[model samples]
Target: MSEHDVEELKGVFDVLSSQIPALIRGIIASVFSEEAGREMGKAAGAFYKGLIEAGIPNDVAIRMTENYISVFTNLGEIMKKLSYKMEREGKIKKEAEEEKGEEEAGERAEEQ
Candidate 1:
């Protein structure tokens, strides 16, 4: 890779180092046990190996892998929050539909 590419990869690694720990903490809290944390680390390592084997420079691969973890972690938070919001909206809509149905049924009975 060119010098520019190396610098960009270093930047990515810096960003990852700053962000990934918090992301991992959040992920562990939400989905994985402490034991699973170790496995997750190993899996990330394997992914880095695959990237290197695919012709990515080792340093660049490692850096990008760290950034990838951070990106995924942020993505997970966004998705989780979105899902929660959707579920809440669905519940609200269901409740409104039920209320409307009850009102209509009462009106029909009264008319009859």
Candidate 2:
């Protein structure tokens, strides 16, 4: 590729490197937010009620609702794990001074 093409690719990567982590963090926050929890609970309850109305067994409806909730929780967990992995690999910055401050605080607590 030409020099111009390489420079354009690098610029794209620069923007993406900063934005991707923030996007993932935003998604994780939204997914686990209290409002989301309430909405999920309502949706699950409605689903279970609908199933029961259709003559599904109570136990089976409960199992289906549990599975529905698990899907949301699992997605949040996966994103959280991905964020941690990126931080560890230095794909996302953890800020050196922040980490040092946390470590020192932990050491002080341990001595207490």
The best candidate in terms of TM-score: 2
In the range 28-93, model 1's lDDT, one tens digit per residue, is: 466545665686688898999899889999889989899977775676677667555655665665
**lDDT of every predicted structure (CA atoms):** 0.73, 0.83
Compute the lDDT of residue 112 as modeled in candidate 1.
100
Q: Give the distance in Å from residue 59's predicted Cα in candidate 2 to where it truly belongs.
A: 0.8
Candidate 2: residue 10 Cα off by (Å): 1.3
Q: What is the lDDT of residue 46 in candidate 1?
A: 91
Question: TM-score for every candidate vs. truth?
Answer: 0.52, 0.74
TM-score of 1: 0.52
The reply for model 1, stretches above 4 Å from the true place, is 1-30, 49-59
